[model samples]
Target: MTIIRTIPENEAVGEVAEIYADDVESLGYVPTHTKAMAMNPAAYGAFQALIRSVAKPLGLRRYELVTLAAARGTRSQHCRLAHGAKSLKLFDEEQLERIARDYTGAGLTDAEVEMMRFAEQVGRDAATMTEADSQRLRDAGFTDQEIVDIAIAASARVYYGSALQALAVDVDTPPTLGEPLRAALVDGL
Candidate 1:
């Protein structure tokens, strides 16, 4: 059960409602994490901005891969469900299963796999990352700017992951999220 009651879509008002409205129109639904974050307007705004900034440059598919790896590493049910749902729409069922099972085994290109690995390391322990980690990403062809963006994405996941876990948020199993992906999100939770 959720520690705090999430504001339902219909019940939201003012800025929260506006945000939800936009999300619904764009993504076909307001994700549960977004609703939970609406508990604090400033945090919700920051979350939205961070999502846009990190995701827009890479586009949605790669962003979802990075997010899935981060969510898995963080063991954040909320992000797992939410991003898993989005990922389903971007990748085929087989590819989604691969990402959910083990992104490295998912036939990701060498560079993309490296990116996901970097995301996992940063999500699990940002402080432990050393020059070797940076060098590995650099060797994989990720530019300095892309590496910084990946770090920013991982930082955003950490912030949101902690919030979702602290809130004891229930994972939402949207119909569009699909059974396999849903199972993956709730795995070991």
Candidate 2:
């Protein structure tokens, strides 16, 4: 059970309901994470806005890759499960398995692998990131804007993963995800 009471979509009023409705319409279901976030409407709105503003401009695939790396580095079951599900659409079963096992060997382009590595580094040790890290990303073809957006994406997962863990929010195991990705996230949990 969740530590924080999740507000039902029907019980939410005004903007909350509106946001929930749109989410449900887009996703075909209201995610438990969103409901948990609804406890603080302002925070939820800001978070949702940040996700859209940062992620939409970048390709969803790239953003999802960063999210996956951060989720793995942080060991957040919720993000690992959720983003893994989304990743299946972009990667094949064998590729997803490789990513879950070891992203470095997942057959990604040099730029993508470098980005994931950078995201993991930020997630694990943000303070330790040096000028060389930034230079590496720039050399790997990430522009200044993209680097900033990558940081935002990684930072967003820190809050999101921690909140979901604290709330004990259940990770949804959608049928589309199959077994490998699910196993990757919920294996020890």
Q: Give the winner by TM-score.
A: 1
Error of 2 at 186 (Å): 4.4
User: All predictions: root-mean-square deviation over Cα?
Assistant: 2.0, 2.1
Q: What overall lDDT goes with each candidate model? A: 0.79, 0.81
Native-to-model Cα distance after best TM-score fit, residue 141 in candidate 2, in Å? 1.4
After best superposition, candidate 2 residue 27: deviation in angstroms?
A: 2.7
CA deviation > 4 Å runs, candidate 2? 186-189
For residues 57-87, could you state the per-residue lDDT of candidate 1 as single tens digits?
A: 8778778877877777788877777777667
Worst 10 contiguous positions by lDDT, candidate 1: 180-189
Model 1 off-target regions past 4 Å? 5-8, 27-31
The C-alpha local distance difference test score for the whole of candidate 2 amounts to 0.81
TM-score of model 1 vs. true structure: 0.90
Tens-place lDDT per residue, model 2, 1-189, is 687776777788987797789777766777888788777889988997898888987689899999988887778877887788778778887788778777778899999899888888777778999989878889999999998898899889888888888888887765567786678655522
Q: Residue 162, candidate 1: how far off, in angstroms?
A: 1.3
